[model samples]
Target: MPVHNSDIAEAFRRLADLLEIEGGNQYRVRAYRNAAATVEGLPHDAARMIEQGADLSELPGIGEDLAGKIETLIETGELPLLEEVEGRVPEGLAEITHVSGIGPKRAWKLYEELGIETIEALRKAAEAGEIRDIEGFGEKTEQNIIDALGRFEGGEKRLRLMDAEHIAEPLLDYVREIDGVKQAIIAGSYRRQKETVGDLDILVTAKRGSDVMDRFVKYDEVDEVVSKGETRSTVVLQSGFHVDLRVVAEVSYGAALFYFTGSKAHNIVVRKRAIDRGWKLNEYGLFEDNERIAGKTEEEVYEKLDLPFIPPLLRENRGEIEAAENGELPDLVQLDDIRGDLHCHTKWSDGKFTLREMAEAAKDKGYAFLGITDHSKSQTVAGGLSEDGLAKQIDEIDELNEELDGIRLLKGSEVDILENGKLDFSDNILAQLDYVICAIHGGFNLSREKQTERVLRAMDNKHFNILAHATGRLINERAPYEIDLDRIMTEAEDRGCFLELNAHPNRLDIDDARCKMARDMGLMVPIGTDAHSINGLETMRFGVAQAGRGWLEAKDVLNTRAPDELLKLMRR
Candidate 1:
């Protein structure tokens, strides 16, 4: 097995978890966690670098000792130190930490008080009313544990799209480098640019007697080969993602791609249409009485069915086929249509780069403008700015605007909407900026009506221009708190404020369904990266992909307009 960067990262993370549970040195545990983060976020394969005999210590956050451990894991697929730590700590206790609201300390406490080292044990304890008797746990905490356990049993967790890309792209490149490969693509939800994917479907056209399957199973990241055949194979990557590869003839490549790249609902509707036309559609080709009609290209497949071609992103069975039949399909938003970013951070708060650096990075990306919307005083953990601090930064931005050319900076703040629905800063202070991005950072446990009302009252403020991360969801980590989105959308439309499609991978909060709803309500949506670093700006592409999935066009996105037009809309 090839130890990819993620594998090494996971090992380090597990080591840190075990060490923390064992009550080891706090700083040492933190070092391992930070090293894991840095390794996981690397743009290239660290394992490949090790293969080439590169020095791992040069990588960020990886010291000499950590580098040696990484090399050992890559070389042996095992870390003796991690194994020893596992010996001391109950491995199931680590699993307990995965439950929402159960941190390392909490897991340790559970093990100490109840001998509950596994999820099943914890659930059993909670259900039997044994957990409520423990210190710091009551009826509500016990119920929360039970609820989280139920959610865990509901389904296998899915990977974020970007993480899937990290695994798939390198594997695709390796496949294309094979001796007889001709064409290749990663199909399924990845092709549709879905927010998360269950697995990857890879399709390839190869020459006769090609060794693509052999090559695929032999890849370094293949932790397990579930099945392998001449034309099709399924393998589990080291990162726990399953991949299915199919080697199809060139003649049937198009049909195979279409068949595999589906929202099952979309595929069902398309197949029904073909059947109504006296044609059979499957992975091989579109057929009439065993004679192939069309299969070489997706365009031809759609043409044979007398329907316009549909972009993969729009194939969600959400009236897209009907719209295509009537020639009413939207001109979906593309990556190039965005003109600027309306919400990003800088060194002024929690961002990684300085203001000038962020501006230069945005300018390099051909953006006409960028907004510096750091957190307000409430997010002190993120170094949120005080009123006086914001005043000075506003002046600094004005100075940068005069010095800079080709790009403009908008002074703004990601102001917190307090529990009672007041902006973090006063109206007079907020009015000094070009715009504001109001958000909820705390009090996620409020009731649906109160949460909705809190947001409604905040949006009622004149300075509340955009609602950031409307639901405050963190994909696999946290569920969106209870809130009625319909009333919020209605309020946003009537108030002239916009909603943000936050582009961060963890929080694509205003999901596709909500984006369509906002569009239908005739509200402008801004695709903000909520970026904190230079590389973070590139997350805009992910945002655009999400917008495309939502059936949005350039006209529906606020930041697609030129700076003057965007400012004019803001002033409205």
Candidate 2:
């Protein structure tokens, strides 16, 4: 019996293979693949859809012949064609084909000649000479298999966001072509803009899937096309991310997307909680032992779980689960809730925009004020401003404030916290401005204990009002230096220092989990776009989404306060 989530698709795929193995008509073999996608995408269980008399012919490729076969599967418990296919094709071939570099032709050759089946067996054979002996197999193929094994090394592994996107776009585009497709989107970490993404999961809604299976295989971008079915299909993007496109009816699109775009841990916690109350949770709709309960969209998914629908950015094994279960998810934060930006560079140091241009951009963004934090004297690589440069920038800012219509600009520095717990700019240089956002630009080799201490001491500098990019993590480029987030959050909170939620997509640092924890600790969180240019200001929306994931409300944000109020907090 098919048991996996992707089973229905797998079943039809097998039928297609059996057609070839039995030397059946090519069109006849294609029917099984077509029917599989239709079955997979009905928005309800395939067995249930069949029992309710939903016509498989609604799918484009499925006609009387294949529809009858699918009806038999639900009614009789077996397919004559499936049995023949199983007999002729080795059971292990489907899984073997799942590996990145392997295909049915290679899988067939391995099974027929070398008797290779499971991924492990194939790995072993490839490592040895079993695969090399195949007609087309060579060292290159062997190396590719080895690389594939490494790619799939960890359980439910993760990938870079760029890698995940490369796979998702093509599949999402194809999903819209399914007979019933009405809307489509990519959800989960990929949507959340997480740096390291797992497999690409897409959300889709369709009205007719009878034609779905046939259309998916026809997508121009799909490569090494392995299997096609009525409701769904697994295709390898040229980029090597395995995308499984799911088809569901328009009514259930929202719920299905919620289920598929999950942090598995988040879903498990919600599902178990539902089961505790005699409700079943799944992609289609929440059920009370097979009775329709709630589900039409993502909101329903959370409502059924007895919590508000959380956004994609907030689903990572963060505190959202606990917050939701407790009926205490923070009030949703909106993009407009942010009133000021605390981390920005000006051409006075590393930024491209002049002080007036930066202030004008902030006004355009409707911000009450903007913090112009240029590099301090120590970071000369950024053309760091020396004392005289700081004085000149301050004079320029004061003149701009006098002449400018609205947005007020504050002079500050992204000052380096030197190795020995000292700031790059002196008190004279710091006090001449409105605020300071001290940061760690280097010295990552210090012990976690010393690094934490160095930052805490910097926080004590009365002139330094914000801790910018606290972890100094740069997504795929840099690892978060070994500092204790718990300790860092505590110190920042105790001292009333603003914690930066850097909005650089590469550094959504102090991510939602830490962000939630910071909220729990009653720490002040400032959502900063850390814009290097005008285009970067848009990144604040991502930070707002992240804040929502942490269950933070407008009141919970530091910059949400009026400029006068914010200044009071920074001064204190």
Candidate 3:
């Protein structure tokens, strides 16, 4: 029943969507959306902060009014404003807005014109060719909606890794505390650090007569107990996320973990290797002529298969088994390998923290340096710096650098790559910065060729150091903008430019596959947190996990180098 940051963020997002559909003020709607982002990015639970007597208003984008509302939500399990807005907006209208190519305003227009408030109603209208008659919505828009609906309906609902973490970690802690439980760990895709997970698989080791299953089914957050047994149980949490728990004896613990924590394809290939050796392998143990040989640990199982232990992140059957056999498996990047974050923001832009605070936070995290890449002039909504403003910031950074110790702040701008492939700032202004991080802030619907050309042209500039986000994706909320990433990687390699693995949970852009592509193309991938606040810096671990999954080693990441070396590498 604890109110997590994700829950608060979801409430704010729902309220914003409903208010937008109800024709609310633009700034007010934006405030809620930004608040949702801030809340979602927070590393700690808002309810726990309040419990510890911390002021919620101190959080970025959270004002006195928003903080009071958060308190109401945490204390009363409801947000009064959200409840009020939900009453004013047609419930289905908010859902309709979730469809791609449809915004709240479009949803409202659809409702006003055709009385279409539900997705099914909209689908009926689109299929019948009635939607194309709407003034602004033409045949193309109608067809796009039908296609979008097909995808929307067919796709399974899965939680983003971070949201699932917020739910699963607490449940994990609960299970680990059970009296007779000796071990508890989340397995499957969560173990492999995938961006999104369908369900949680928990494996536990417990003593005989342990009541682990009984206690797991009675957990506070469980909405329903789907099935329960002595060794295994399945439950659904209040958020509609499902979990399965299995209890195993200590002897078979590792084998159970190995089987359950699987990319099924990886397991299949390994099992085939065992079969070729005239042995059988499964959840309980590896067998030779019905005599148990090895299964006491995952290492034992791997050793018996004549393979080195494969990291969970590389268990996607993506050449990892072959690499392990040949001893060519990468050492893989770890969270500790990161020395600094190359992309973050300050109060100079839309970020909540000042330069000094962010630098100190970086120092606190043991980073040797932190890049302060505030927004360029084009992102006015994010308080993007004007030419004069950027000049002032560059000067301020020089002065702060002189006063600061232990950590260096690299001067930079997240310069927008304009639709026509022009940098937002002139080269003269860009020359003043230590480095540049170019990104696309708009024009997500550009054709693939145009998008690729835009990025390529931007990289042609000498000041371009890193391609931020690379693909402008927002996990489940938005698809990656169309572009030939292989060509982009090739161009980046040729141009001495790097691609970013933006670590922000919502925008783990340039996803795992692209990261691997960059690696194979000999491109250095910098894992930038795109941090807007101090707490936002904690997302670095998620980025590292993603990089590991992509087979990146320490040498493959840009920020893994020392301050001087990283700066040298950034120099074109």
TM-score of each: 0.90, 0.67, 0.95
Q: Which 10-residue span in candidate 2 carries the lowest summed lDDT?
A: 1-10
Clashing residue pairs found in predicted model 1:
none
Candidate 1 versus the native: TM-score? Answer: 0.90
Task: Give the alpha-carbon lDDT of every model.
Answer: 0.87, 0.71, 0.89
Clashes (backbone N, CA, C under 3 Å), per candidate, total 0, 19, 0
Error of 1 at 419 (Å): 2.4
For candidate 3, the 10 contiguous residues with the lowest summed lDDT are 148-157
* Lowest-sum lDDT 10-residue window in model 1: 148-157
- lDDT per residue for candidate 3 within 402-521, as digits (tens), equals 999999998999999999999999999999998999999887666789999999999989999999998777777666777898898888888899999999998888788888888887
The sequence of per-residue lDDT tens digits that candidate 1 reaches over residues 22-117 is 889988997898677567555566777777888989764577999999988988899999999998899988768767668799899999999989
TM-score sort, best first: 3, 1, 2
Give per-residue lDDT, candidate 1, residue 530.
85
Question: Which prediction has more favorable TM-score, 1 or 3?
Answer: 3
* RMSD in order of candidates: 3.0, 17.7, 2.0
